[model samples]
Target: MATRAEPIRQLRLRTPTDLEAEAVRNVAGALNALLADTFALYLKTKNFHWHVSGPHFRDYHLMLDEQATQIFAMTDELAERVRKIGAPTLRSIGQIAGMQRVLDNNADYVDPDDMLAELRDDNKDFVQRMREARDLCDDSRDAATASLLETFIDQSERRVWFLYETSRRGDGTGH
Candidate 1:
């Protein structure tokens, strides 16, 4: 006898909030993209951490591990923020890949300095993205998300600063 398959039920986890539907939609959209980028950056940081070599191996490894941990910490809060606003967060790695703006670095080997420079640039871009999201939150009057983005932006800026300093040579410029 053939068994009938059950139809999937669409779950609507609509949380009640004073924010308007449009505002929720806008904030959720921005947050979701940011979350995806966060995941991408986290993975890249971990990759570099695991693969790093040369004289500064221990320092670079520890720094990337710390940065990776920090990046991973943001994922939960970002998704929760989207859900709190009555929207569905990203459900899969595929969703994250689709939405992520940060480029992946899948190479056999990379110079440690090059890795730091690349991550610095990516983090700088991420800071701008957060700023844009904060502006959107301000426009939507979603002070909660705006405040969260502010914290994340500051953290990202710190990451950029670290990467920039580490990658620098004699002149202090990363040249």
Candidate 2:
């Protein structure tokens, strides 16, 4: 005899009494995209941390490790925020890859300076995306999400600053 298959559970969002359902949906979508980008950036930073080699290897490696940790930390918070608003969050790396705008580095060999520059540019681009997400939250009047994004924007700006300073030449002449 053939066994009967279990019925799939259909999840439904219990909309919060305080927030508008439409706004919550919009904010959750923006947060999911932001979450994807954060994951991509986190992985890239960790990659650089592991492969970094140069006279300043210690400094660059340590910095990337710390930055990767920070980026990773943000991912959970972002996913939780989406769930809190009664929306589904990212489930797999493929979902993230589809949503992410950040470029990946697959080269077997990358110059130390080039790695730093590439990461620096990527972080800068991330900040821009964060700003766009924040704006969406603001427009939706999702104060909680918007406030969280402010902190993220500040952290990203700091990362960009650190990367920029580290990549600069010590000599008076800038590269």
Candidate 3:
């Protein structure tokens, strides 16, 4: 009897684009990293949304839920951008975890103030990363990707601002 052939495990689709191969590769890599970090942040935000408890429980919970929803919204667009640029996108959660730079919070309990502070820092860092990715798109002459990054960077900046305000003490300095 003839041996059965194994199915192809890694399939690379060729999406046509005018951009150079190296440019596509670099932008896709950056976008994928951003995508991974987005996923990580979304999960962390939802975790806090679910576990948060304090005098401001309702406000904190609602804010986290909104932020998580916004973060999750980016995933599909990011992945599609990668494909549009003639490159492959993230395949699985393992791929996301491997590429993610945003730190995960697996703690059983985190103080409400601490949670806000942590998310603030994370959002700030994410904005910086998105700026870097935007710069990469600029260098590669990828206007579409750069434009998308601009919107995401703005959204992340707003998240950072909200997080900072929410976590601030009565003192205006927030020191």
Q: Tell me the number of clashing residue pairs for each predicted model.
A: 0, 0, 0
User: What digit string (tens of lDDT, one per residue) describes model 2 on residues 134-169?
Assistant: 898878877888889999999989998999888888
Per-model root-mean-square deviation over C-alphas = 4.1, 3.7, 3.7
| TM-score list, all predictions | 0.91, 0.89, 0.91
In model 3, where do residues sit more than 4 Å from their true spots?
1-12, 171-175
Model number with the top lDDT:
1
lDDT of 3 by residue, 1-175 (tens): 4334322322347588999999999999999999999999999999999999989999999999999999999999999999998888999999988999999999999999999999999999999999999999999999999999999999999999999988878865645
Report how far residue 152 has shifted in candidate 2, in Å: 0.6
Please list the residue runs of candidate 1 whose C-alpha ends up more than 4 Å from where it truly belongs after superposition: 1-11, 171-175
lDDT measured at residue 14 in model 2 versus the true structure, 0 to 100: 44
Cα deviation at 146, candidate 1, in Å, is 0.4
Q: Rate the local accuracy (lDDT) of all candidates.
A: 0.94, 0.86, 0.93
Worst 10 residues of 2 by lDDT: 2-11
User: What local lDDT does model 2 show for residue 48?
Assistant: 88
lDDT of 1 by residue, 1-175 (tens): 5334322222347788899999999999999999999999999999999999999999999999999999999999999999998888999999999999999999999999999999999999999999999999999999999999999999999999999988878654735
Please give the lDDT score for candidate 3: 0.93
